[model samples]
Target: MPPSGPPTRPPTDDAGARADAYATAPLLNCLLREVAQPLDGTDEPRVYRLPSGERLLRVRGVRRPARPEVSVDGDWRPVGHAELVKLVAEELQAHTGLSNPELPAEMTDSRDAVAALLTARDGATSPEDPYRRSEQSLLTGHPYHPAPKARGGGPVARWLPYAPEAYAAFPLALLGVREDAVAEEGDVSALDAFGTAPPGYRLLPAHPWQLDLVGPGLTEAFADGRLIRLGTTTSDTWPTAAIRTLYAPEHDLFVKFSLDVRITNDVRRLWRHDLLSLRRTDSVVAAAAAALRTPGAWLSDRGYRTADFAFEELAVLVRDGLHDHLVPGATPLLAAALVEDFDGTLPAGLRDPDAWWTAYLGAVVPPALELFARSGVVVEAHLQNCVIAVDAAGTPVQALFRDAEGVKLLPEVSRAAGWERLVYCLVVNHLVEIAEALRESHPGLDPWPAVRGVFAHESHRLDLPEAAALLSAPTLPGKTNLLLRWTGANGADARYLPLWNPLAG
Candidate 1:
């Protein structure tokens, strides 16, 4: 046992074993958190019962559950990815009284995708830039999603070149929509730098992978000269963890595209409605971000361009880069990256872990709560949406938030509902994951008290009633990803179950 109790690290160095461990942890977390009933006070291997106690499952480790086993023939038999997927399907179908053939396949596909990524990553070079490396480090994408890495069940070859985990860098496929057929809004001038259009066309850059996916359907448009291929960008755009969005380091801009494939809960597309409402939502959140006394910024979604004929399919969004927003000398790393793995990016000895975490809480927590209380803007402060800038001493000094599409505005959503969402995103999804990661690294160090201190301070500082209520609340709303997928609910229709609040006293 390696001090933190029975070793959380895998028993073997085998690639498949590592991949299985990486892939299994998230599924096991979802199974245990959302569906499984804990048989607390049970000995060594922690145990949980399925919805009806018909099946007993147990796993080692708490933060990232591992070596899942089912009690069979009065003995615990370890289960692999396939067996686990089948087990999950059986339990979900029995519990929900619904059969989801798609989710199970996605679960299997996700495991296979992880296997492919693990193999590709072994021989691939990690990005030289620290920020880019941090962004690409998420081999395990969402800690709670059942299939966080499912790449549409497509072949590895089709998806590997664009995967950030593989340190992918490729130019955007430039296209020219006939000037009269172009649909554009806001400032898409950044797209003009990639390549020139013909005399009567406007520049529109598309994700090459998305182009391949939508290519077959574009035969008619190509034949009619509504769209023309204009080669590729001279500079390569690196895909961020949100695979559809790519960062053009040379141009200092972010270009997000419409990916038809489903990632996690939704089809990763620049949706038509979301595109239409971008300005309204982003402007509100941006204003709140700008008003912050704390070190924080919102990477604005500047504008978008697409073919009027294929509105949603080829739509591309232009977003602000970090050059203008980042603190003078501070490096802005993806917040998700911190929880995933630092990969030796941070200098270790500058600050004690607790002090570093306190600085982090101050930098990240205030902005979301202030925005929610004063401006009625609920920024999705989830791990992926945040970029925390650590000073030279590895202390968090600033936070930059992005993805305007995810921000929810006040009057449009009821106050009660908005507050619920803010708590779920900022506290449960974002803080809890990062806190757990921090705790795992330095065992016996409790992080929640500092979190409680931050919340208490914010509640008093902002005079927000919701913040006070949060500390005393017995349970926090946890998004039911596994059940949501199994029930085939709309991605936007979030259903939550109570997760015992860590801050509860």
Candidate 2:
């Protein structure tokens, strides 16, 4: 008899093809669920109900959307605005049962089109429809995100890729051109090196320099020697699709970027940090470098890794050797400085700075003692977005920050006139944000010793009460509703305060 076990079939071209298709499994699943099936073979596209209950369409001639074919710096031909609207509307009508009548009148209006379309598909009109809105809501209006309209009629500093129809939850943006001009057809790792692969992932080592060419708009900038190269790092430990790099030209310092767009439920760990209530926390950390007499400017590209390339791609460039000394581990201090008051309340095992387990607490403690009011602004201060550098003695000597993205600036202060906003941001929002992470990661960690360490390292005359006040105060929850008292896109008020000032009473 034949082998009792299952017989293995020889691998064929079809088998190889099946293996190749796995990379696009997510996209295929999307198409299959959203497109509909036809009763019989017909020349026209057919709508089918997927087993998952999603509507999908199978077009006879149309294939899956291929990776972008155009080269970097190529002339960009947009699908005209009118044509785009027609395409979107037609696609929705053909695939989903909803017709023009079912759509909100606002959808027909070009100004609110996207919003209206989302509402219609979301079943906002009826109570019974089960439509799961995409995750785009998480970041769409996030305070740290650049305003939709450019600040000065120019493109915002950051670039994000957005897919209106697919994975709308993922606020996609272009980082740069792919490293390769052509599809690999065999080994795609080469594409990754060339900037063709998604962010937060690295190509196989065999791939060459992974140089992604810059786009035309920034060509003159590079030709004039306005841009410089920066150093690169690839971290497999972090989420995929994140990249970080730093560059400095004659005057301005720049950071290369990308982010891991996936959302995790570990909200407390990443955002809503407790350390954002510290006093002059930004200055305290920045002062370390001044005291150490370190040279050059600093930028935060900590959220992502930076790739090294010969030329800029899609007009994006990463400079070399800019942040060589800056490393990841230093994050714990910056986080410590943000929150943790030394004097006020004593939780057991927290007061003694000299104790062994408590010794490191002094590293996170403050020197001055005073009752300092806390700010209410919540900050997404995590290890990934912070930087601290230490000296040979293991003393934290310097701090660097970057990635204004995810930064929550108090709307009132951001728009108002004064250094209060900046002070609140550097000290209250950014510096202390990292502190919350340290406290949470190390359960046995005490706030005072760490607070005292920061103050002692910075040469602050130890005043326990003031320092305690700074650390003990609870940072504002980062919820903006209290700041403006109004919600739902009515536009912001002229007076907005990012940091909560309860002392005003």
Candidate 3:
């Protein structure tokens, strides 16, 4: 399939205007969802009141909110992306009675990053492969993040060559760690396939950008022969939506690296604590996926390799490839791409909303619910986490789930907390966006009844008390991302607010 009309490259003469709109949508969504309260507005543009300051706010668009206006001196004034950041900061400080200098800068950085991505796209060639297009199509990044595209305030030149948004693919930087300092776990034989190491060293492929980020810090290691640069691999690995993770098609394997840059909620590092327990978590998730009666698959984080001195910074994780798990002849598409209306790839000219939604629901819902019901595992099946495979006709046939770091097992956390996260990730984060995107085109279509039906069926089949409870609950847990960031809470420490349940009767 040819590459889709990249949403980042609009026909508009002003690239800044396109970048501003792209960046502003998700920021407004975060502000509106987390902090603002709805007001009775008898007008075209919806109005809201920022609860802490009693400031009147108005916004346009349903899915990704845009064209924000705040009332001043009895007149509504349009707020640009920068002004929106300031406005959000002021409202958040008053609302929480806390100060945060970092979030505002991150917000500005996110907008700047979009401008860079837009500029890069003009010169860069988009990948022709359907899967690659789907992976790189997330121009808006996250639907409800204050600064989803923020690249840790780094230079564009440093990250552009490695960015999936720019359809970038490059050979892995091969490093040889002295065997004594080589820290590893589980099956990491896949690393040997990339390139050979020196006489007393083992191969550890690193994300080139990550290597540069931590290179200066590893001066002593290089000096002491603990680490040695063995140059780059022969094959090129294309970056996935998760910037740190890469897919090498020649090997049909995924290699995840730790980059100290913050993307969205947290610093995207493969922490030592997490790596220590990676095997245990991945095994359970794999088993859970195995127990599923439907066509579900889990891309396991098979093993990891890093240096003892700089474990977290230099860590590289090996993940299972799509070839092993996906249905024969089916193409895997990122779930996030489905949420973007202009992604221009799969389901763009989708007809028969009822049938398509049914296929999608069949492909996605069963795996998430059944995994929890049978094995007490929450797979964090959000848009980024889920992968939907479609038949040649562009009809979804299977769902594959990944990222063991995000998975939570029962008894590790309370059943209530796990269930809330499952609902948020699966329903609120994953399904809601896709449903809304579908509704935007097929206006009269109602996806809720089908969703409720699936829930009704699965809950009854598995006798899941939480799923049954959700059928009648007044609200679903909506994560407080904007507030959480503003208050300097841990990204994993999810705090949720109530959203009116569409699943409820």
Top-lDDT structure, candidate number: 3
Greater-TM-score candidate between 2 and 3: 3
* Candidate with more favorable, higher lDDT: 2 or 3: 3
Error of 1 at 354 (Å): 1.0
lDDT of 1 by residue, 204-317 (tens): 999999999999999999999999999998989999989999999998999999998999999998889999999878878888888887777899998899999899999999
lDDT of 3 by residue, 50-72 (tens): 96655888988888778888995
Q: Sorted by lDDT, highest first, which candidate order results?
A: 3, 1, 2
Q: Output the lDDT of residue 285, model 3.
A: 89
Instruction: Name the Cα RMSD for model 3.
Output: 1.6
Global Cα lDDT for candidate 1: 0.86
Cα displacement (angstroms), candidate 3, residue 472, comes to 1.0
lDDT of 2 at 460: 45
lDDT tens readout by residue for model 2, 1-505: 0001112233332422332222122222223323323446554443333332332333322222212111124432333223333433444455454455311122122223233323333432211100111111111111121111111111211222122211122211223323332111211221234223344333311111112212334465445443322223232111111222222222123323221221111111111121122113333332333333322123322222222332212112222222354543331122222222111111112333234223332322221011011222222333333333433333443444333333333332342222233334434444343333344444555444444455444334433333334344443222232112111222222233334422121
| C-alpha local distance difference test of each model | 0.86, 0.27, 0.88
Worst 10 residues of 3 by lDDT: 1-10
